[model samples]
Target: MENHLYDGLIRYIIKKTRLDKGLQQRDLADLHISDGTISNVERGKVVVRDDTFNYLLNKLGLDGGKLNELVKKEKEFIEHLKFRLDCIESMLNNGYLELANEELKLIHLDEFHPLAPFLMYLKGRYIYKKKE
Candidate 1:
């Protein structure tokens, strides 16, 4: 599960960076790898060796260390988001509807995000409380 999460996150980062830099997958190709492999990596459909992964990042001009730093920060932010959601849940359980709603307003996560279902569940709970 953890490995899948890492792969997905890496895929997002690579694709976003490549698009942002206006580079096509073929642009990353060299003698060591093909554009199809690059596409597979961006889609999280295949795992490559560490050297190959680093090579792809190098092609995007993103240093491996810098990518690691971005990953660390992303993980930290996700942890913080989970903590906030827990707090919102606790607020709802304790009948702090306004506070939970306020916290919900502060959060803006993509529906495809891993924790989005939890957020949706909380929203349902909040609505139930209102109906009561």
Candidate 2:
């Protein structure tokens, strides 16, 4: 989900700021946020609401510029991945198995990337067909 990307970016920034400021998760307790919520947010396991996000940022004494930049980078990464996936799909459709396989190798997806499962499926299909 694109929302996850945005939330993940914000969460990462918040976590980084916390570390840089030497603030522990418990330090935010006065904000009335639970430890589980803080942990989930730090791990990017959940999306934080806008108001709560702003409150967290304010508490961290961080400017929004870093968050904005991270969000922009996230969007750019998604667009680039879409382009690569389209190229791979096209190569496969044209029966250029080798070319598709080469393109798949160039994908450079992170282990926890959202498209990892789809990429795995494509890779398995490619491998299965290659050996046939």
Candidate 3:
């Protein structure tokens, strides 16, 4: 589910930051944290509570406020991209080839993007319509 995806993303970020700082899971220990909790969190075998997650972030010397802001912006950006893809699909379905092509031009999604296949489908529809 989307919640799992968010958890995965957050855990991955934490793991990456720890590694980038040349710290191992054991190095992130807190007085209240038991052995292996950090490792389990990094591996995502267990879900970390917000307080524990914030503690881990603090141990890494990361600014939790900034990280939260980045996550918020990323969510908003994804929503906007989804909206654009929907508009592109509607344009293609309505036989508005010129408008569809123009809208497609504005989207620069990565080749491996989750929506890439849908974008390709829309482009194919535009191409097929042109040959009609």
The TM-scores of all predictions, comma-separated, are 0.63, 0.58, 0.49
**Candidate 1: lDDT of 100?**
98
The residue-by-residue lDDT of candidate 2 on 1-92, one tens digit each, is: 12342555566556766877788998875645766667777777677675665666667775577567766877787777878887787777
lDDT of each: 0.79, 0.70, 0.71
Off by over 4 Å in 2: 1-35, 42-62
Model 3 TM: 0.49
True-structure lDDT of candidate 3: 0.71
Q: Name the 10 consecutive residues with the lowest summed lDDT in model 2.
A: 1-10
Q: Model 3, stretches more than 4 Å misplaced?
A: 1-67
lDDT of 1 at 3: 32
Please report the candidate that would top TM-score against the real structure: 1
Q: Which candidate gets the maximum lDDT versus the true structure?
A: 1
Clashing residue pairs for model 3 = none
Once model 3 is optimally superposed onto the true structure by TM-score, how far is the C-alpha of residue 42 displaced, in angstroms?
14
Q: Which segments of candidate 1 are over 4 A away from where they belong?
A: 1-8, 15-43, 111-114
